[model samples]
Target: MFEPEKMKSKGLKLERMANRLSNAIEKANHNYEIEFEAANKYL
Candidate 1:
């Protein structure tokens, strides 16, 4: 027996997790870019 409400909640939970992972990756990449640019100034 499948419950529609449970399915919807599970989908939403997965979506939220995916979004958080992507945001974290973007923040890490942004920080890396900033550090790289700053290091370039010394070279």
Candidate 2:
């Protein structure tokens, strides 16, 4: 017995979680790039 609405919501939840993870990764990379540039300026 599969519930269509329940399945749909589950998919949406997974998608939202994945999107959050992706955004976090992007932010981390951006911060790292900024730090690297700052460090390079010291050399």
Candidate 3:
């Protein structure tokens, strides 16, 4: 017997996970471009 409250909690957790993933990708993209550009000056 599944309950509605449990389902809502699971949905909330999934939403948080999605948000974290989005933030991580944005951060990686920003850092990668910045770092590469900076490194190019030395090479």
What are the root-mean-square deviations of the candidates from the true structure over C-alphas? 4.6, 4.6, 4.8
TM-score of each: 0.70, 0.71, 0.66
Ranked candidates, highest TM-score first: 2, 1, 3
Worst 10 residues of 3 by lDDT: 32-41
> Model 1 Cα displacement at 14 (Å)?
0.4
Clashes within 3 Å, all models in order: 0, 0, 0
Writing each residue's lDDT as its tens digit, candidate 3 over 1-43 gives 9999999999999999999999999998888433466677789
Compute the lDDT for candidate 2: 0.89
Clashing pairs in 1: none
Global CA lDDT computed for model 1: 0.89
lDDT of 2 by residue, 1-43 (tens): 9999999999999999999999999998888433466677678
Q: Once superposed on the true structure, which residue ranges of model 2 sit more than 4 Å away at CA? A: 33-43
